[model samples]
Target: MRTPTCGPLDLAAWLTSDSMANTTSTASEDISELIAVDEQSQDVFVSRSFPQRTGNTLRIGYGGCTTAVMIQAVCKTVQPQYQLFSFLGSFLGPTSIDHKIHCRVARTRDTRSLASRVVYAFQILENGSERVCAQASADFHVPEPALYTYSIPLPTIDGDGPEDEHHAPSARTLLSRGIEDGHITSSSANSYFTNFHLMDQYFDWRHCLTSTSTQTLLSLAPHLPTTHDSKPLTARPQIEYIRLKCRLPTPSANWAALAFYMDGGLSFLPLHLDHKSLEDAGACSTLDFALRVVETRGMDFGAWHLRERRTMAAAGGRTLSEGWVWDGEGRVVATMSQTGILRPRGEGKGRGKL
Candidate 1:
């Protein structure tokens, strides 16, 4: 991959240029700090070689490459000209942080209204072997006249900002909801398990199902739900309000951001269905993710998106879940589905802990 000269130092100059003055309404200084060049959240024109990999806890030297980031890298190549309407990606393997990811795009099909492109991501091993980490095919469409449009009703849920004062649910909300759904039990004092939301720094999530009531500090750890005399029902569909900490420039960028957001948390739907905790649930990772853009008429990055995720099926160590993203006004933004692998802990041992 060839590196681009538009680094952070050149960003200010790009923003003040006459070209940008005609594009953005918001001032450069007023822009959200969440914008990153390689991430494609802004309009500053970042290229392929811009750094994407960052530090990871694991010393494998390969940094984490998120599904969303990889998708964004591909979408940016055709942004503005054609907005991404659909994407299907397969995560083949993990890449090291030490090596830069190389994205290769190929135009597969095109017509007057729609176009398709295939993307492949690869990382060079220390031994100089190029390992394929992800492959994706995205369909884009040009703006055209539509005769009719409709969207299914969104489940009743609270959103962030304005009257709500940006109070999205913390990790405690997940534990509370898990308990209410009979999927989680309170952990014993000896259990070192804790809510992971305390470490969250980006998106704010408001879990509508369990947010109506408050939870105690002692109530936050994962525990096995108790059984009833009669067989318990399956876990309810999980719903939450997810909002980005920063805003992006275009609709394509927003969609890319949504891709990143859905890749996380949604995969746990299967564990919720089986009433299992992270420690006992075994190892889990997203194998593939597919997203469809239902309508983009009024998609806004600044507004809170209602994300409703539910498991469709799970068997043979694999799980499938569907997630819907809607804007604050109830306009459906996008629908996402993911397939994940769940290996039950024990049996032997796995690389992923809890």
Candidate 2:
């Protein structure tokens, strides 16, 4: 299948087309570039470039991208010692990629060891109207001695993992590789289940021993969740390796990159476990997210890390997915949770980040 190319200048042309692809640059982007926000005034910030939309051409703005930028914008107003520890937010409405974004930061609280910030993002429309797109509450904390420490062990898996020769820089790389092998159409993006025009340049992901079944979440004994939370196989688990395509200049930039990376495949984790794709669903979109960075010492976006995710629940027109990221040595680095709308087609509901 053929997918259309959209360089930086392709926005105008994309806005006029009847397509489900985003008007996003096909060229790869670094995390710093994607999160770079220009200070407009005391606490307000503006985008240096248009915030990117997800692969879904239906114009679903990437919720993670907005969250990442919000985190960065908040970082600018906080003390250097206080790093982001927690963030809770929701996508307020759909966003247009054709316009720049403006962020307003509110200093909610400030103390010696802790700081709180509330951030709101708005799309600066062509007509000069500003519409609220997303909002988030972030907490920053200075490094402190741990009073107690404990973490679940990484699951053991039986299969060729990401270290094998079959891995690529991103998950979608496998989809494109299919085109090279003539297994899929090389010309049209329409033939694919999802689009990755913008994300292919930001991060690399390597999948490992992916499976879903009863008894074992992946149906493998070694790969069971070792936590006390495990209740006789309640969810499907997926494992992958991830790293940024380029180094982020600051620790704050690295944190934002993790925010973006963790948002992947969340709204559709259920479909993924069913061995299905977006083609099997009417529409899916993340409604809310909560993230907590466990440690502030190792802020390395350029290094490889292990990421594991599981579907916590799916019901009542929404689904929840939880994820954990760990350093190469198996130390827990961060945790992310998302709830989203997922349903069959013909529901008459619109599709996009909201």
> Considering every candidate listed, which one attains the maximal TM-score?
2
Clash pairs, candidate 1, are 61-97, 62-96, 62-97, 63-96, 63-97, 169-205, 185-223
Give the top-scoring candidate (lDDT): 2
Q: For each of the candidates, give the backbone clash count.
A: 7, 11
Per-residue C-alpha lDDT of model 2 across residues 93-123, encoded as one tens digit per residue: 6556655667888888999999998888877
For all predictions, the C-alpha RMSD in Å is: 10.7, 8.0
What's the C-alpha lDDT at position 19 in model 1? Answer: 39
Error of 1 at 288 (Å): 1.3
For each candidate in the order shown, give its overall lDDT on alpha carbons.
0.54, 0.69
Backbone clash pairs in model 1 (N, Cα, C under 3 Å; residues 3+ apart or in different chains), count: 7
Candidate 1's TM-score:
0.69
TM-score: model 2 vs. ground truth: 0.80
